[model samples]
Target: VGGAWFAGDCAALSECYSAGSQYSAAPILPDPLVLPTVQHLRESWDDYQDAVEDDPEVGEDGFIFDFAPDELHKANISGATHEIEMVQYVADPVIHGVTGRSGITLVEYLRVSISWGGMPGWSFKPDQAPAALAALRVRPDF
Candidate 1:
């Protein structure tokens, strides 16, 4: 859970300081997970086609996203940062679960999703995507 992608994306604003202790307990993992930055979401997506093509669980038409820290900005409003995951997928054997849905496997996408303008505190909907914020990368990762 500690990598360039995770740390960069997990960067938080002062508002979430109270929750700082939560991320400290991340268990050390053997796989070198990339902590991708906003700069890397697309790169990770681009790099993952082999995963999709190789895995039975993933479809060729996969959906990449503004995952992890990019999505964290939405969580910050509701103090729900705990809900997101801090990792990325690898190509071989196709890591089945890496998203924030309590380990449920969301079908991979070939591109970033248009915003859905979520309920209440979640509003990354295409129209509602927030203005650029240094702490998070809300940009679509196409």
Candidate 2:
């Protein structure tokens, strides 16, 4: 998706038992983390969307701005990426609308709280999203 994409994986190479009789410690491998350092968007300002970007009434700051393309396009028309930017979120639980794909797949977050604000960062802001992000439908490979 657009905005940014980064990821990291921590695989245990070995474990040791703790005083309580539990294998609590694991030695981490080198370069245990992998993630993007820059921010990018999967979707960009295409020619057809230039209008939406230029429309004074509906562009940029509209209360319910739809980033749909002006003409026929796959992402927008097919709901594969009908991105929108409303003046507010109101916790609608949806942002990017798409089919054959989870609308919130790229937006939905996990372990978002005080502790995770610093993973790629400790912040829940969308700008801080890393490759480790996922949707509810996804499963963590333990």
Candidate 3:
């Protein structure tokens, strides 16, 4: 597995590095037999969306209920110099099936940036450039 550097403001962070960030990796399945299951999951998600849209209490505000506002706020805090974002298996989908089912997982690492807090407040010193550059060489496409 590999990691990347994601820079910019909260909007960019939300669009590229946040929880609902898009995954560009191709699908991985050990066998073609899992197609039905995959289809079912997709259909189930569509149905779930419909159900939410029809529900008065949950979908009345016109937005699908997902993460809590506070949680999202914490995840997208401005001026947060050090933070970690989990890159799920979907981002780099490769799975080995031992049985009929496979479990999804994720890789996480701390993303340290001086862009938000400015250089004076940055904990990452000049000496750490080589290490930081080595660690974050691959910037994924959004």
RMSD of 2: 15.7
TM-score winner between 1 and 2, please give it.
Answer: 1
How does candidate 2 fare on TM-score? 0.24
Q: What is the lDDT of residue 142 in candidate 3?
A: 28
> Each candidate's root-mean-square deviation in Å?
12.7, 15.7, 17.4
Better of 2 and 3 by lDDT: 2
Candidate 2: regions farther than 4 A off: 1-55, 60-82, 89-93, 100-138
Ranking by TM-score: 1, 2, 3
- Which pairs clash in the backbone of model 3? none
lDDT of each: 0.32, 0.29, 0.28
Residue-wise C-alpha lDDT for candidate 3, range 1-142, written one tens digit per residue: 2222232233411233353323233121111011113444456457666877777565444322121111122224331121112223236332222122233111211111222221111132334332333342343232
lDDT (Cα, 0-100) at 93 in candidate 3: 33
Candidate 3, superposed: residue stretches over 4 Å from native:
1-48, 65-135, 138-142
Expressed as tens digits, the lDDT of each residue in 9-102 for candidate 2 is 2222111112221222312111111112223222333433566767755454544333332111221122122355545656453435432224
Off by over 4 Å in 1: 1-38, 68-142
